[model samples]
Target: MVVKMNLKHVDELSGGRKRFRRRYPKSLVPVLGEAVFQVAMKAREGGALVSEWESLMKTYDRNVAKAERAAGVAGADDRLSPLELWREARRDAAAMLAAFKDDLTEDERRELLGDELERREADPVLYRAVVEPDAPEPKPTLLDAKNMYLQERLEGGTGRNNKNRLDRVCKRIEATLGPLNKLSLVDLTRDQARTLRDAMLSTRKADGTRLAPASVRRELDMIKAMVSLGIKEFGLQREADNPFIDLPISSKGVAPDVDSSKRDPLPKNVLLAMRDRMREKAQVPALGLIWRLLEGTGCRGAEVVGLRREDVVLDGLYPHINVAWHEDRRVKTKASIRSVPLVGDALVAAREALTLSEGEPMLFPKYARENGPDAASAALMKHLRTVTKNPRHVVYSLRHNMKDWLVLAGTSERVENRIMGHTVGGLGDRVYGGNDAKLKVAYEAMEKAIKGMP
Candidate 1:
């Protein structure tokens, strides 16, 4: 006889003991490893194993009943208790035969184990279809790709330095601009530019003086550059619709005009007076020499500051200082990189300043504990301001004053532009003819004018 058991689900498998759909007493067979305890559970959960377990349970029950009946009647082997009889029945040939037949039953067993194996093999393709069922997936963003592209052209060395400076300018614009500025900058229109021009003109400096029109104009130029970059490089706007294209900018009233000799260039009397004062009042003769160099050479504040001793090529046919590669020097253009012949007071000053340095940097080495080279330039300008009684007319006036002399002596605009590292015809011109020798000749003409000055 066989006991019947119901089907069981697989999820019930857990911690040491095994449960089964079939009910049975503990097995008389001695258990082996931990897995033996789950034999009842697995046998019940599996349909073929359930039937085998039930048959084994029934055989044990029958054998126990036969042993109890035999013991009560004082039959043969009365010493064998019911419990002993049950244990003995586990090894009985009759019970073993029933279990073997159940194990081989064709009706109860299914090839589910093989089915599971088949499913596992196909899972990867099936799972991919379920998770992403349509078109091809997109690649990662191009931000890192863009950075990698720019890394070579715009991210390191000299190119990187310019890129970083441009970033700084952007930061400064964001900080300095106000809400009304948004109206002007947002659309980049001519009306907006004119409105901004009016707005900036209405504003005042820290001291409450009305800001100069020229100051407003320079700032507008910076805004124009920012807008141009937005349209050209960043693709923020369409080129045809770019507002900076034909804006009406008032070139009227900007300050610190390097071209305005009347406002910027130290008057002849002022220049002479400052030179005399510098010779007498400066701590060293070398400081007096630097003053004369600025007065004579018209070198930019940065170029003069960055001048190292080795840039002085004193042995050439036409001896001139190479302003191109001064350590901190940023020539406004390639034309500005050309050599300007040293002559007259400027030559004498350059020679005198060179004598003071024993192959180091400028005639005046930077002071220790300074953050930058700006301090020395500031000092030179301050001293000149004190002597000239024109605090506004700083050391850069040297360049202004020289340019004024150039213009006053009938130097052409192209020559002045070359001397100043400026280019004509706009963006295309700068890109195509980066270094024109014709412009270099014009710069040389400025040097000649300075030499011929009284």
Candidate 2:
């Protein structure tokens, strides 16, 4: 397998300091520092394939620049730096090498360099490091490379939870493979990656049960990503497909499928007790309001927590809350990015929460002040579970109940999904939008359902 160089001066790219990353069949894109002379700015690699020998010019020129500067080989011409002379010499060397040998073996190439080696050998520093070609370029460790990739990755583009997941997989894989910072790029291999998957499969949470299928699958996928990146960054050449590419996600013979039945709907009696109990409490009025919104809208807790005062549309024909994505918080899916009509206790809660949080940006200032959604869920769930005194009946059960409520109310499946921020299975749902009429109907139904309390 032949490794190719796709050299570019760092500045030629749009952003100033995004590390240049290339993948597969070994293309060399430069991660070299800022300089007065940027080579690939003009002579781009993708333009034409001149000759294989040209690949060495960047290395050769860099070596020449180092050697010339050390020996102070300033020419009579002041226009050129020592680096400039190195550049010209590398171009000439590339042409001669192209003419002399089309596909020379290592021995042939070394023989061609015999005289040049002798000339440069006069200076031990230049000859051993360059002209003679045994020394490999400095390689970054697995941790260093992963750090560079993730730092650039997480700072702007990736979702926060995803960024955290990537970090977690690397750490867990490292635990399985041994210390990552000390490990060579070669340590990241198919066998080592298999070890990670095995470890994940055997992994357990506090109760000592084996990891869920979904958890193992996520870890395996992330491991694959890390191993593939390491291979590309290190420029490893192999005959087989990437080790991480096709690992089977196993269920270990049993159905390790996720129990989607976890968030069961609240029974009508239990919900009424919770609503009536929470609503009048002064200890956490915000909690009651938020619970009602979740009940009313069938939206996730995170969506409710991340809601800003500006997003609540009370004046609109159908008062609703926006479940949109924000920089700080992301919804579960694209379908989670719709408005849910605020009805019943939800409308009352939204208005009161708005009044309490008038000066603040977020509707729920406490949860958001700490960090949106997840923190809010934890706080509310603990208290909610204590009061409800039922193991399965928790805060998310409100959302589940909303679905059942809508079905019972005779609302169309389309409007039910729209209100719940779910994908309306049919394409026509999009052709005819989520109109005010549907929202009004859903709101009326939700209002009736929650008012069953007193």
Candidate 3:
């Protein structure tokens, strides 16, 4: 008689449950049991368990169907007699044993099978290793460029405007310095620098206007700086000496009429009135303080945006703000990092507007500090005018206005320069061994200048 057993079905559930059910033909018992046992044995013998399990399922079905057909007939015998069936099963089992005969342990078989299964799931394409290009690698060029840029900024008394000018100059050079298929460094003579200067001058703007002299000068200066930097940074010279030596600067050369005027600093009463108006319109205490702080400290918009909570030292004996780090995490200049005492109206305003979170960056300022935030100081200026009837004001006018106030207050040039962090005009005495107290004193003067008003 055929030993029959119902088929048991197992299902996996997400909530840590295995569902089990039994159904169908009774004769399937031995077949399924044998199939399961064969699969388990294959798994233990370091065989392809999934393939082995599938093959066992097929074998079980064939045997069960043959047995059922035989049992249905009046005088039919089983598909295989008990000994024959045993022999067939033993032969199949022996094939699995032979395949993994060299394997030392059953655990190894299971481990190997698990590894194969994992590898199958995570199948990666096999590729031969390729040789990287022999081209000179991209060394720390960006960081080095940035460091050099900062160094120049600190040394040359450059500002945000100068940084922008250099950026534009480099971009233009990249455009012109291309298609160098034939021009070798050795082929370039000092006269080529003159030729380059002429070519850049002859280049037209999108509007067909000839390039401005200032623009040309800027480009030349950038090239000179690049050559100087190349000697220092990369030793990139065809000759032992640079070819750019003795390049001519025209005798009658006029300074290009680049607009150097910043927004006039708001007068003390106007600034206070503007603050009140901004607060009423923006309806945020922070917004009001934004104008207040700018008017009081004469900070550039970028410097204001770069302010952080930790940098604000309201708890100190002198109570000062460190204006060093930018929102993008770079100091504008070494001079920019020095602490400005929170004296005058700026101190009063900072203390009043101390509602900002300590660790998180200021949201309004983050826009300029980030890669693509709105940086047009004009926008803030426009918004301020919309709220107040004051004649249109430029954002930088605040600094200019403050400078005027400093002069009007009869504050000495040294005191004003220290507060503004303007490079001291004198050559010898200007070299500072440490932080200048004049910076703090300037803040005191600024505070006195503003507070002296109604």
Off by over 4 Å in 2: 1-164, 183-187, 226-242, 280-282, 411-413, 424-454
lDDT per residue for candidate 2 within 331-365, as digits (tens), equals 77887787777766677788999998878766776
Instruction: Give stretches of model 3 more than 4 Å off.
Output: 1-167, 174-177, 180-187, 199-212, 238-246, 251-277, 283-287, 359-365, 372-378, 381-393, 425-440, 451-454
Backbone collisions counted per model: 3, 1, 11
Candidate 1: misplaced stretches above 4 Å? 1-198, 207-209, 212-214, 227-258, 284-286, 325-327, 361-364, 367-373, 404-454
User: Global CA lDDT of candidate 3, please?
Assistant: 0.51
Q: State which candidate has the highest lDDT.
A: 2
Among the numbered candidates, top TM-score falls to 2
Q: What are the per-residue Cα lDDT tens digits for candidate 1 across 1-454?
A: 1112222322234443235433222332222111222334344222244344444444444544443443343442333332233334333423323444345542222233224425765322223333333424222111212222234333222212444544543434344343222322234455545555566667766889775656555555655555554344434443324444545545455545444533576777778777778887877565576667666667765565456676776674455666775323445556567555566777777887777765555444542111123555666666776766764577777777777788887887765665565555566544555443553565467555875455
Better of 1 and 2 by TM-score: 2
Q: How many collisions between residues are there in candidate 3? A: 11
Ranking by lDDT: 2, 3, 1
Model 1: lDDT equals 0.50
The 10-residue segment with the lowest total lDDT in model 2: 20-29
lDDT of 1 at 422: 58
